[model samples]
Target: MRIATWNVNSVRQRLDHLLGYLGAVAPDVLCLQELKCTDDSFPRQEIEAAGYHCNVHGQKGFNGVAILSRRPVEATAGLPGEPEDTQARFIEARVPDGGGEILVASIYLPNGNPVGTDKYPYKLRFMDRLAAHARQRLAEGATLVLAGDYNVIPDRRDAADPEAWVHDALFLPETRERYRTLVSLGLTDALRATTDHAGVYSFWDYQAGAWQRNKGIRIDHLLLSSRAADRLVDVTIDKDMRAAEKPSDHVPVRIDLR
Candidate 1:
């Protein structure tokens, strides 16, 4: 089965791009981040009409997620964390792949910019919660795909110039360590695992001629559990999508499982 993740930036602003991607990619399952709209305002009809089921975890105008599957899915909204946490940044669903089912989640991990603020602490705490949950799920022996815009550059090779991002929240030492801790729990970074090439990136800034210079980073990732990794066929980052009209700063990443 083919599973994909993409941070559309804003679903409302990229409906056409979404449709075009669905038509072109035809992935069995698609996990999306940053829907940037309420559930009621989501273009469910449009997506559903295209023959996919849409399970949305949405906030008013920030941090939202959705999972779309060509097959019937059992969906659960929200990441398991602080009960008072209201950010709509995670959504999980089970989609059938032949005789078995794969658990897929879309996550828009907090960007955690300007490290001195409350946001940075919140971001770190969220990673703690996510790591705990991931560890538990991995122990349960599920074939899983925790896919999304992680808002992290896992290694120096993931960025065009590592030095340029050292002060950024996404590349901070603590943040990378947290990400490493999460992946250390038997989760495979699908794209990196499949390809050893450097300079492959999934996000480019909308400002400062970043894309034009190929100055981008690989923050969007598809992390697969051991069971899922065993079936890994390949992975790809749709970098060309970023060059399309009115693109998101991010692009799509896909994984194929046998």
Candidate 2:
């Protein structure tokens, strides 16, 4: 099966780009983040016509996530251990794969900008909650794929100019340490597992000719549980998507599993 993740930025704003991608790439499962619309307002009809079943956990204007699968899915909304957190940032689905099933999550982890504010702490708390949930699920021996825009630059190699992000929330030492803690739980970062090559990125800012200069970062990810990782075949970053008209700053990261 082929699974892909993309932070479309805003589903409505990039509907055309999305439809084109669906038709061309046709992943078996697609996880989406930053939908920026309520569930009822999701463009369900258009997506359904493109041959995917939608499971959306959405908020009005800020954070939202969804899972789109070619096959039907049983979905769960919200991250466990955070009942008070109302942001629509996490959604999971159990998607059928051959005779078995794999758990897939669409996550839009908090950006946590302006490090001194409450947002940074909230982001760390959210990471803790996610790690706990993932640990539990892995202990249950589930085949899992946690795919989305993690809003993290896991390593210096992940960014074009690492020094430029030294003071940024996404690249702060604490942030990367927490990310390492999560990975230490035995999740395989699909891309790094495939290649150690630097300068491969999944996002480029739309400002200052960033894309033109190839100043990009590999923030979007698909981290796989051992069971799923055992079957991993390939990982691809669809960088061309960033060049499309009205493009999202992010591109799709896809993985193939046998």
Best by lDDT: 2
- C-alpha displacement of 137 in model 2, angstroms? 0.3
Q: What's the CA error at residue 64 for candidate 2, in Å? A: 0.6
Query: How far is 67's C-alpha from truth in model 2 (Å)?
Result: 0.3
Worst lDDT run of 10 residues, candidate 1, spans 94-103
What's the distance in Å from true for residue 50, model 2?
Answer: 1.1
Best by TM-score: 2
lDDT of each: 0.91, 0.94
Model 2, 43-66: lDDT tens digits are: 999999999999999999879999
Deviating ranges (above 4 Å) for candidate 1: none
Model 2 worst lDDT run, 10 consecutive residues: 80-89
